[model samples]
Target: MIAIIDYDAGNLTSVERAVRFLGEDCAVTRDLDLISKAERVIFPGVGAAGSAMESLKKYGLDKALHEAMKAGKPILGICLGTQIITSFSEENQGTPCLGLVKGEVLCFPDDMKSPEGEKLKVPHMGWNNVTVLKDHPVLADLRPEHQFYFVHSYYPMAKEAGNVLAETAYGLTFSSVMGRDNLIATQFHPEKSGKPGLALLKNFIAWKP
Candidate 1:
């Protein structure tokens, strides 16, 4: 069974729907013991990092997630979920995150300019193409030319260069997907990305590492 962590974070329903659409067993819960024993965990989030972290701690889900990670179980994070997996984030007044991955989440400046000197959008919403950088089980049957749905203001700056699995271009090239060992995550909403995203999620479900 896959445990989907719920901490009052946005987009939980969408993720659960996607998982069920794939005909898989998933429980949306905040229970620590259930999560710890799950075959896999899907840490999906869409909200403020500070409040999210507070909720994680309030329910002791953070420690449970860490326990799963240390056990080498496969885990997937989305959007803010991915952000909190890092050390810190500039969101919601400089929130410190899980530190599960060695990196920091930084905000996109409002003044960020395009190559053509045009003002780029801060949150970088809509569909964007991701360039595959390395091979990973989660990326099975995914192509670099494919685009994914994204809605975010900040992006991850993974300190470990090899952790970056794929990247996408907006005003600048930013890390879109990252994986290390049994942990995998994406900045875009695979749940909302339609066919390609569903395919990726299917791969994630079957991925062992």
Candidate 2:
């Protein structure tokens, strides 16, 4: 069964629904045993990193996640889930994160401009296409035309360049997908990205690593 971790981080139901829609058995729960026993874990969330970390520790999901990663379980993170999996985030006055991945989450610069000299908006909300940097099973079916939904001002930056799986361009290019060993994360919300997003989740469900 797939466990959709519930840490008061928004978007849990949406991810659960998406998994169920794909005919996968999943549960949105904070129960430690459920998460530890699940074959796969989906860590998807929306919200501030500081509060999210508070909730994660409050339920001890942080340790559960660390254990899952160490066990080589196929773990997927989305958006805030993706950001907080790293070592730290510039949000909330430099909040420390789960440290599952060697990376940092940084906010976009205040003066971001598009290539055409147009001012780009912060909190990069909307659809964006990713440039796959390295091939991985979970992203095997993704095509060049496929775009994913993004809604955040901060983006993850892996300390190791090899961990960067994909990148997307906004005012500047940023890591859109990151993975190492059994853990994979997306800066975009695959659960809300329509067909392409579902394809990603479907691929994830079938991924061996």
Candidate 3:
């Protein structure tokens, strides 16, 4: 069973729906015991960084998440969920993150321009093609130019370049997929994405490490 952590973060329903579509037993809960016992835990969010952190702390989910990671259980974070895994975020400017991964979320500079002379837009909404930078089980059967849905302004900057598994161009190439050990995260919204996105989820469900 996969446990979807519920702490008032947005998009829980979509994630749960996808998990069901994958024919997997998934439960959405705030109970730590359920989360700890689940085969995998997915953290999905579509909101501000600081508020999400507060919600996690309020329900003691943060500690549960840390413990799960320590146990080497698979944990996947999406979008804002991915941001919180970093050390800190410039999203709310003073917000601290889960620090599970060494990185920071930063907004694109207004003057940032792509190689094609297009000014990178904020809240990078729409379908963007992701270029897989490295091979991993999460991206096992995924094609190189897999299109995923995205809607966010901040992107993660890892301290070590190898942490980045995929890169998407938005004015400049940013970390689209990050992986380490039993953890995986994506800045894109797989639930919002179509077939390819669903495939990625299925891959994650079947992933060993």
lDDT per model vs. reference: 0.91, 0.94, 0.89
Q: Best-fitting candidate, measured by lDDT?
A: 2
Candidate 2 lDDT over 76-188, as tens digits, reads 99999999999999999999999998999999998999989999998899998999999999998889999899999998999999999999999888889999999999999
* Model 1: per-residue Cα lDDT over 1-209, one tens digit each: 99999998999999999999999999999998899889999999898899999999999999998999999999999998998999999988899999988898988888888789999987899998888889887897788678899999999888898999998888777788877889999999999999999999999999987
Off by over 4 Å in 3: none
lDDT of 1: 0.91
Tell me the alpha-carbon RMSD of every candidate: 1.0, 0.7, 1.1
Clashing pairs in 2: none
Please tell me which model should have the higher lDDT, number 1 or number 3. Answer: 1
* Clashes found in each candidate (C-alpha, N, C closer than 3 A): 0, 0, 0
Across 40-106, the per-residue lDDT of candidate 3 in tens digits comes to 9999888888899999999999999899899999999998889889999897876899988888899
What's the TM for model 3?
0.96
Score candidate 2 by lDDT. Answer: 0.94
Badly placed stretches (over 4 Å) of model 2 are: none
Best by TM-score: 2
